[model samples]
Target: MASAQDPATAQHPASQNSNGSSDPRKSLDGVVEKEEERKEEELISPDTSDAQPETRAVTGWKWILICAGLYCAIFLYGLDNTIAADIQSAILETYGDVGQLAWIGTGFPLGSVATILPVGKAYGIFNAKWVHLGSVLVFCVGSAVCGATPNMSALIVGRVIAGVGGAGLYLGMLNLIAINTLEKERPAYMGGTGVIWGAGTILGPVIGGAFADSSATWRWAFYINLVIFGVLLPALFYIPSFNPQPGVSPVIKLKELDWIGTALIAGVYTLFVVVLTLGGVEWAWSDGRTIALFVVCGVILLLFMAQQFFAILTTPERRIFPIHFLKSRTMIILYACTACGSTAMFTVIYYIPLLFQFSRGDNGIESAVRLLPFIIVLSFFIMASGQLLGLFGYYMVFYLVGGAFLLIGASLMFTVRAGTNIGAVYGYEVLIAIGAGLIAQIAYSVGPSKVPPQDMAAAIGYMNVAQIGGLLIALAISGAVFQNIAFHDLNRLLSPLGHSAQEIHGAIAGSQSSLFVNLPSDVRDTAIELIVKSISSIYALVIAAGALCFVTGALLKREKLYDSKPVAAA
Candidate 1:
């Protein structure tokens, strides 16, 4: 009801003044608004074709030495992932227990998943350089234990311990790379990690097989980690101390860790992994023990979630998991794509060798050699994608194109039969390798780019969970699927041929089994076909993971990552 020119209905100061000249403050406000708009436009626009390289935090001889040390640690982490597979036969010969075989492969990933969040929090609260060195020391100790263990149980315990350290090493390496490089230059360095990681992953089984076949023995597979760590030890001391909480005392920083939350998360993940590992192998799906474990895991997970939100165990500022990340659309989509990509990569890495061993009758060395096409293509493309990202800033394109390739590749793999041409199989491997390489390490670069400088470490840690968690879950699921399907199909068809359950299980174990070696020609041929069918079924999981990558890719914003100035802590 007020008049248009009345004080109650006055116009905005920028609109007009009494003399019809613009107010000085309003002119300044106009300029500021326009500047902000320009920045926003730049953020959404594609990067220039000829962008110059930005200066890094550390350079020259120091960075090179640091990189050598970090890459060596990363290689060891990747090597440990699949090394146990080819060496399983040797372990069985020494220990005589086939039932515990799954633990050898699973223990490392389980340890990583259980402790990664707490390790992430520690990096946020303490000196990153010392934390990194401590992780290296822990990894070395675990390796020494594995090398010296006299029994299978002790070896598994060592693998789990090694996994704990390996998770920290992996996350810490990524964090160091993020903190040391500018946002614009991060992708290239991240790609270097990808190259090393791929080399180690592909070489794992080969190295293990070589050691197992030689007088050096399978124990040296683990002992090799310590040797690498010792060579790189001095370089680590020279690395910069990236202390986020620089003024905090060590005792106070220790108190800031969410100890109860760490225990709860560790308990939840370990129980869940145990259920997955033992579900059909050690116990029936209907077993009360499995159900109880599931229930316990769920309850602990609920408690952990509550702790993050309610701050019952620690302040929200000091909590391990960034619960608020759930609110970010970008983060959510990135997490999904990362998980899908990781699942696809690990599934292929673990199962492909088994397929070759069963279907082509290849030994460990031959199967590892056949994996070369996939690993090489994957490594090359990972490096390419990273370099391209730094130049183009169009990360969405990689995820979409990579996802499509994965789908096509996995579909091709699903059709492979026992007599399929090896050349065609290698071609299919190339397609999948390209897809995985393009997307696998992209998240580490992309994730930190999107977050503020203060949250960069947390973002890297979060993606680590997605990467390692997806691998752990996928391996567990595929192993269970392969074993159950192969066992059921083999028992139904071959039990009438006088094959015992133990013999069927050994066949499921693959060509390494003496029981499989003793089978008649006709029986072996039939067993191979059934095993091939089981392996083909596992590709269905890969296909699902690939589809997820595509769908999530479609959901990400088409904006380029912009550099954020470092924000000082209060």
Candidate 2:
């Protein structure tokens, strides 16, 4: 037998044949080694040495300050989304175009979902610090525009712009944390961000309501963002200059972006939202316009998916969809769960206040105040969920329990009629809050935990997209359901009360449930009942979404939480 260290024996694992032919085992070994090397090269971060300065570690007060700035940015983003919910009524009152009201709320998320994938890729190619600061500046500009807008169209345009900026802010904040903090410490920082997010959810309504109720105009609601942005601007400087792809030229990197894919996705999302918000409200669902929109949306989405697959096979580096991540059964289930949970949460946030304002006859401020129980419980659990994850090192239980809570809460919300007991309603809100808050931060944890270091950014982006997509789809579907039901019920209830077809059409076109206030007592009571029934129907969807979360949670593969080594900062 040849010695173990013999070159011939090492190179050719299989014994040579009678002649001098190469061993098949040796060829197989070589092929496997080459394949592994290729995979490693593909996963490597862009060359940083030539393009960026030496990374100085962010520590002590400097790290604290950087985190503070990022948290503020997050707070601003969350506040923008929630503020629209409470102040939308005030906006309609001022603008006097009820038909345009949904745009005010949809515009921000539309902008967010449209740009998120592109912004995530942009961070990899540009200086993260500059990219983040530029986003903040854009947000400020949009806020200013919103504050100064003279018409509903301008306000919607400003909101879309602000949302685009917000997409950058959100991705930049998460990327900064991941790169700057030590791996072990990241969960704590992430949890801290979640707390800020929860606080924003609470404060958004409170502040928007306060402004709406005060002598101040609803424009101030947007102006407040500028003030917060000013405070966060200086902190941006303290953030470390960490560029993973320092040597790459911006022009080359720009070319590598899947612009066509991005456009297709944006078109699909925008059209879907338009169809949802306008169908049955501005145009009949069976109308040619609505059918055309749906056809276009479907074709665009299919094109986007095809582009994603093509990019993955031909140019994996440029693909926005992380094909590898999708291959994991666990990751796919987690994304589905995240979408369901998000739909439930956003549905509650947007509609709960409307429930108060319309069903119970509360003003914007009063409706917001009534949501304190939900907000407070949600805020508490957002932090608690993080702490428990740190202590117990498990997430499956949280999802299972949280989903159950959400189901119960959504079912309870269905019972909230015009004269439902306040205590019971408050209790239901608390239950929903706890479930939503607990489930909210887990995806952020689980997604990064599962992927390789190079794929962490993509994983995070995917989770965020899932969340925003959920909100978009939920808002669209629920809005369609609510409008269709309300129109049918309103017509049936009001026609017998001496209201003319023109009057009924005007009221439906107005799209304000609060219009019931102007009706005769008999009509008002009946209208309120119809509105309650219509709105309550939406919670059934929420319940189904919650149940999906629970099923996904139960199906998720168990992984040792916090056991994996942190991926090196890009």
Candidate 3:
């Protein structure tokens, strides 16, 4: 053994390989001395920490496979969420009015948003592998329950179960890859996930229409989730409990759980939705239930902010929410755009089909099938936007394109008379799809790009929370508008025909075709015209929403998309 700094080693610090052979020391010729050799007769081996993450190039393939698994999970999750919308007709037919039927769609995302903080907090304390597995299992159980349920209440419970599991899985899966996979590799994985998710949206309506058209209508929605979950569970089991960074925990391992903050957010959000839900249907907008709920929601939301401020100041474990995120200009703008874009996109999807049924005289299957073009265009544009982000290094363009397309789509609806050509109707849907594709990919990508790598999961979960929250909020508002237009038109016209206000309201509210067709010939034509008028007006409101998105996009600071660039270390 020779010390390189010593006079003797300086002459020739010749060292054998680990086998004590001197055959050019296997190439580098001991240019790098073994760490173990410095300490003892048996040299200390280099620790894994000293090695490059993606050593072998062959090791990269393993991660690609894991990413495929994650993509499947995202795909199935999107499919399940949207498929219910496709089956809304079946549920409404079975359960009666929109008010009674609304629970089917709201329950899942509600559960997802509610469970985020808890699951996120757990990610630090528990192993992500086990946590993700439990999430998949929970989702499976929910699917089973929904598939088996005979009643709406039972079905809603299943949706909640699925939501809870999905929240954990969706949150955990990305971070599991982002945190574990090599930096240069993440973009492809993320891009792949986006493609899978887009593909799922593509398949949902066609598959949903086919299944729901059969006797199994709603059950098929859950069945698809079950089949994918079946495949995903085993893939997840293959991921080892290896932490990329481990063997250390902060001195304070847990923040005092933000039970109060969590409860307040849930209360405010739910109450807000409730207030909107009652509007134009169960109670007038100014009625006691709706008014009181609005008041309470506003109060609770303020309290949630108050609680978050206090938690950030006092908590040593860096509270469930990071203080940095709240203060980050990039984060706030991205979140706002996500909320707005999501609200507009989902709101349009939810009601447009119903409008088609009423004004275009299309059935549920026809409407669902019609959206295939939208989904196709959405998928194509999402990829195009990804390439644009790669080339331009700016996220703002997606917002711009999406906002512009959405506005275009909404404005085009003004021409949607009852006799508008089928080609014209399809054009509007295509415009929406193009705008949606641009927005959806950009919206999902923004939070991750803006937030710190360490906060990626929390941010993603938060992003999803915003998206869904906006969706529900927009649903309430849009539904209220639809109700008002339908209500006024129903009363104004039908009352003159000698039908009572109550009778007119009751008929349309039930989603019955006879609500229009049962009238006298001229009156029926007028009722159909009213239907055309009310629904078309809602599209104008959606255009306003798109305008708001454009404003936010203008405000967003540009973030360069470095597809292969590594996330900065915290």
Best by TM-score: 2
Assess candidate 3 and give its TM-score to the true structure.
0.80
Give all candidate RMSDs, comma-separated: 11.5, 10.9, 10.4
| Candidate with best lDDT | 1
Estimate, for each residue in 196-291, the C-alpha lDDT of model 2 and write its tens digit: 766775678778888888888788999988887777678779886755444556886687687887888899989998888888878887999999
In candidate 1, stretches whose alpha carbon ends up further than 4 angstroms from where it belongs are 1-67, 174-191, 240-247, 561-570
TM-score of each: 0.83, 0.84, 0.80
TM-score of 1: 0.83
Model 3 weakest lDDT span, ten residues long: 1-10
Candidate 3 ranges with C-alpha deviation above 4 Å: 1-69, 242-256, 312-318, 443-453, 495-517, 558-570
Tell me the deviation in Å of residue 456 in model 2: 1.5
lDDT of 1 by residue, 1-570 (tens): 000000101112223334544332232235346557877987899478976765765689888889899889888988998887677767777776655666778788888888988887776566678888999988888889898999988998999899999987876776676566654566566656766766787788888877877899989999999888888889888777666555557998789888988898888767876787778777888999989888999999999999878889688777778777787777888888888878887777777777898888777677767778887787788768767877887788888998988999999998988888889989988888888877887777677666554465566677878888888878777777877888889899889988888767766776767767777888878888888888888888888878888888988778664442222222
Per-candidate Cα lDDT values, in order, are: 0.76, 0.74, 0.64
Stretches of candidate 2 exceeding 4 Å from the true structure? 1-65, 182-187, 312-314, 496-517, 562-570
What are the clash counts of all predictions, listed in order?
A: 0, 1, 4
Please say which candidate is ahead in TM-score: 1 or 2: 2
